[model samples]
Target: MASAVRDRTAGTTILDALETYLAAPKPRDPGDPSREEFLDLVHATPALRDHFMRMQRNWETTLAHAIAEESGLPDDDLQARALARFALDIGALAQESPDPAHALRTLFARLRNGWTDFPHPGP
Candidate 1:
């Protein structure tokens, strides 16, 4: 009862923070204290970590659905594509990518075109 409410509230708070970060035109640095503090708090509490993991999976699943619907990709490929997209976004954000928007656009184009390996001439 009370515990469930508390956990729900915590999940909501974290979700809101994450959404704000993702929606921002320009997010704060990856090393920001708030990000570190929240990560530390989660690390210090196993129950909280469980909630966070659930939220993360939910978020990823949502992304996967969108990708599948938009690309008409096979069900077997949805998870891999979702993970690749997730890694690209997180790496770009955490590294404070110079021209992140442009980089993302370029990479997305390659993804759509199946550029899985860099092209080069044989020796």
Candidate 2:
């Protein structure tokens, strides 16, 4: 998933590559457990829960570094951006959407355009 971000040789921005990657179709097993079920299982297993947390942290770190390369945000802000992005992705997955992957692409498109369609008041 982070391959797009790490491979800059593709001549695409991190966001662009990420969006493209997200747009790719993935096969899902209908028999697989739901998100809630998966969480329940994780909570029931101490080792799994710990491992899950560690993996999430490592992914966040990878994301932070990727985002920082383009945004030039300070470390704290970069970390926050990475966390927020990850949360948004999780939220998209959690929601009952007909096209979550498309939603993700739209989000990146808006971001790549500097979100010009929306007004932003500086803090």
Candidate 3:
């Protein structure tokens, strides 16, 4: 089941769709049939939601680890918390702003600035 979810990249696809929707100048109608069908499919399949949640968690953790490594921080709970917090803030920005790409660029710049205090790991 987990393998199936991983293969499908369902969570990423859903997230991409949501971002596209959010970025649209004129959003789709609330009663859109395709949107309704997608929601219905997710509602009818419990495993899909579970898989998405799991994939999202895994993606966050992986990103946290990468951030820790890049920042030369110990791979500890504190670093994970920092990364998670940053992600949550970015998520909020994405939801609130029509230009999510710009929000993401700002996020990456902030993250890079945050890493300036730490010594980079030598290649």
Candidate 4:
């Protein structure tokens, strides 16, 4: 069906954007070199990958629900926006973070707390 094709296309587009955004450099304040240095530290860490993946999944779900409620979009459309927002949210988070480590740490902490509070569903 056309709807299924549209949904697939949208999902692919969003995932591509997220891939590009994640590889981009962190934002910096004009007068602050230390901020860049801190971001470098955060970027250099190998452990942040797991944290990033978890946060991405959570953000995707959050965005889908929020957009659906706000815009009254169809489920498929909302899903597409959720995927697109994955990149946008990461960019926003990078800009807002005081330091790269802090941004990553905040995500990890949130994910940890969420898992702790809710039991995982599985057989």
- Evaluate model 2: give its lDDT: 0.65
Predicted structure 1: clash tally: 0
lDDT of 4: 0.51
When 2 and 3 are scored with TM-score, the better candidate is 2
Q: Write down the TM-score of every candidate.
A: 0.46, 0.57, 0.41, 0.34
| lDDT values, one for every candidate | 0.52, 0.65, 0.55, 0.51
Task: Report the C-alpha lDDT of model 2 over 1-123, residue by residue, as the tens digit.
Answer: 455566755567666666666666667799998867898899899999999888877766667666665557665575646644664464446344676766675566666565557877889
lDDT of 3 by residue, 3-118 (tens): 22233344553223333433445566867766447657866889987886676677666656554554467766686556555664576576456666787666555665666656
Candidate 4, poorest ten consecutive residues by summed lDDT: 1-10
Candidate 1 lDDT by residue in tens digits, 1-123: 112212334345322333334434756676767655787899799999999888766655555544444346664475645553554356346435566555555554554566658787889
**Candidate structures ordered by lDDT, highest first:** 2, 3, 1, 4
Residue 27, candidate 2: C-alpha displacement in angstroms = 3.6
lDDT against true structure, model 3:
0.55
The CA lDDT at 16 in model 4 is 38
Best by lDDT: 2
Tell me which residue pairs clash in candidate 2: none
- lDDT score at residue 8, model 2, on the 0-100 scale: 52
